[model samples]
Target: MDIDRYLGPGHRTAALVTSHGLAVADAAVRLAEAERIHEEKEELAGTLTRRWGTPCHLGLQTVRLRTGTEEIPEPWAGLSLRVGDVYLWQVAEQGRWVALGVADLDPDDEIQLLLVVTDTDPP
Candidate 1:
């Protein structure tokens, strides 16, 4: 996807719709960028694990999500997240990662998932 054209948001814009609302092409670009960043973080995590050892613990800082909010499992309960959306997570020591979860939030209120990093087998 022409990420630059979509995300930059200028006169040269295209119609793009999402569950959230009617977004310009820039929204798509942002999604793509988030995915790319997630991939990079995963790769970094793998490298770190290989270089170090197993059961390595990483400190999480923040996690950004497009939508949804529900309690995620371990290594993911600390970060805030939105329900029914994709999120980008960044850990202070480990790196970054992407996750999607189903959150149960009360109406008129939003709950975000927590952020944590745990070692997993590389694919």
Candidate 2:
């Protein structure tokens, strides 16, 4: 899965795909704990349509937060993300490779959080 575009300039995005099935709410809680503003209304795009392909589900979510007037931290300081901006995260998994993307974000933007896996990994 390619996630380069969603990551803002000069910022880095990281994700972890696990074999365990994590509830959507449970993952959202983790994101909130990381200080990401979780918005559940947004529609996340991307899926495997092939008949014989593994079945994977995609979760789209956005988060907004204030960094205060103080200078933004390194890596995130120069990025375009702001207090009201919404950053996109993609959680995709078919079998065991569930991918998670995190970064500074803007509102209402579309991003691809790709997850590719085999039949062994269930959504």
- Compared with the true structure, what per-residue lDDT tens digits does model 2 show for residues 1-123? 343433543334332222122233364644453342122212222232232234232322221122354544432332224222222222244222322233324323322232222222211
Superposed model 1: Cα runs more than 4 Å off: 1-25, 54-77, 80-123
* lDDT of model 1, residue 93: 59
**Model 2: lowest-lDDT 10 consecutive positions:** 114-123
Position 29, candidate 2: lDDT: 47
Candidate 1 residue-wise lDDT at 31: 55
Candidate 2: misplaced stretches above 4 Å?
Answer: 3-11, 14-66, 77-107, 114-123
Kindly list the per-residue Cα lDDT of model 1 for residues 18-118, writing each as its tens digit: 22221333555545644554455456546545654343332222333311344343334322323333233333355434332222232223222222223
Candidate No. with top lDDT: 1
Model 2: per-residue Cα lDDT at residue 104: 22
